[model samples]
Target: MAVTIFLLIVAAGAILFIYQTFLRDKWIRQKPFPAQHEAILSCNLPIYPALGEDQQHRLKQLILLFLTRKQFYGCAGLEITDEIRITIAGQACLLLLNKGWQTYPKLLSVLVYPSAFRAERDQMQDNGTVAIARHDLLGESWSNGKVILSWDDVEKGVSDFGDGHNVVLHEFAHQLDGLSGSTNGAPPLRSNSYQSWARVFTENFEDLRHRSQRGLATVMDQYGTTNPAEFFAVATEAFFEQPWQLQKARPELFAELQAYYRLDPREWQRSTEND
Candidate 1:
């Protein structure tokens, strides 16, 4: 009887795990995303047109999951509309297209403001002094599952897809980096690729820092030199917005991102170059 009871307990535990991981996701996928959301994606997101049919379908599913799972709040007396929700969801979901169908498990709410917002931050001075400072920001992501954004910047990013400065993508990338239990620029990696990821990221990060210090023109934004976490976020913006340039300027770094994202935005860009 003891052995039978032990076996029954193990079986029940296995069932629960399977349901949480697989069955729940399957159920979410089965639900339909609203038809109006499709129009929003097609109109606002330039990358939507470059995706293949299968990829588009997958992206739609991811967007649906994101919209369903995450809540959006308009701040500074701005009213949240379907356009705001759909636009943000579409871009945020694009990052997960090939990475996984899993919606951002850590992110639960998005706070949006009318324009650039001021944030009060505590700063440490060179003389070992602490000072409070106020700075303007376009977006920020927190480890506690909250993201703040300037709707104005978000609109600008979607409208100017080639600029390589996407506030939404940049902040979301930080969330991805935090998945590894810290936001040190490196996200969780497959066991087989962790060593390669570390080496490539470190080398590229150092090179960027050196270039910034020397005042050299860099293909990547100099803001990436801020830290490893910022590097990953800025690199993500370049990866999606200026794929061809990034691939040409830093093939190895691009390759590392390609391997991690499992999608080739450069190829997508090439295919649509004539359009």
Candidate 2:
């Protein structure tokens, strides 16, 4: 009886694995998002046209998977619409392209406000005093499987894809960062690349901090100096939006990002120009 029970358990496990590996993928593919392609084209995501045909199709699949799996909620009296959903999802999924197709497995929901929202937090002072502070925020990513954004900023980010200030990208990068069990600058990287990623990020982060302190002009945003995590998120923004400028100003950092993301936006820009 014990052996028979064990064999039954094994058979059930194999059946479950087969269902997950085959049936789940078929179901996801058949799930319809009729406006997916049109949404991608109309969203004004400059990187969309830069991708090859296969990559573009994969991106659409990722976006559809994102829409299927995650929930979007409107906040602060904002009304959620397909355009808003597609716009935000498209930009967020851009980061997943050429990487694994997991559409932020840990992310479950997105909350969007009509504009910048006020958030209050307890601030720890250098003097060891805690004080309540309120600040306006455009976007935020929480480790609790939630992402919040300002619809206004989302639209702005899409409108000016070359500006290197995408709120969606920035916040989503934070989500990716948090996947490593902590919100530190480091995300899960291959064993071989971790050392190189650390070295390059540390050097560039220090340089940006020093430049900010001296009031020197820098291609990266001053907000990056806030912390290592912010530095990674901000760098991700620049890497995608201002690829040419980032490549010119900080080639090593750009190279590191290229290796990590497995694509080169500079090459995309070149292709765009040539065409």
Q: lDDT of each structure?
A: 0.90, 0.88
Alpha carbon deviation, residue 164, candidate 2 (Å): 1.2
Best by TM-score: 1
Pairs of residues clashing in candidate 2: none
Clashes of each: 0, 0
Per-model TM values vs. the true structure:
0.92, 0.91
Error of 1 at 219 (Å): 1.2
lDDT of 2 by residue, 1-275 (tens): 99999999999999999879666766785666576555655556776777888777777788878888899999989998888888888889888888876788789999999999999999999999999999999999999999999999998998888888999999999988888899888987888988999999999999999999999998889999999999999999999988989999999999988887888877767877888
Of candidate 1, the 10-residue stretch with the lowest lDDT total is 266-275
Q: Give lDDT for model 1.
A: 0.90
At residue 39, give the lDDT of candidate 1. Answer: 89
Q: Tell me how many residue pairs clash in candidate 1.
A: 0
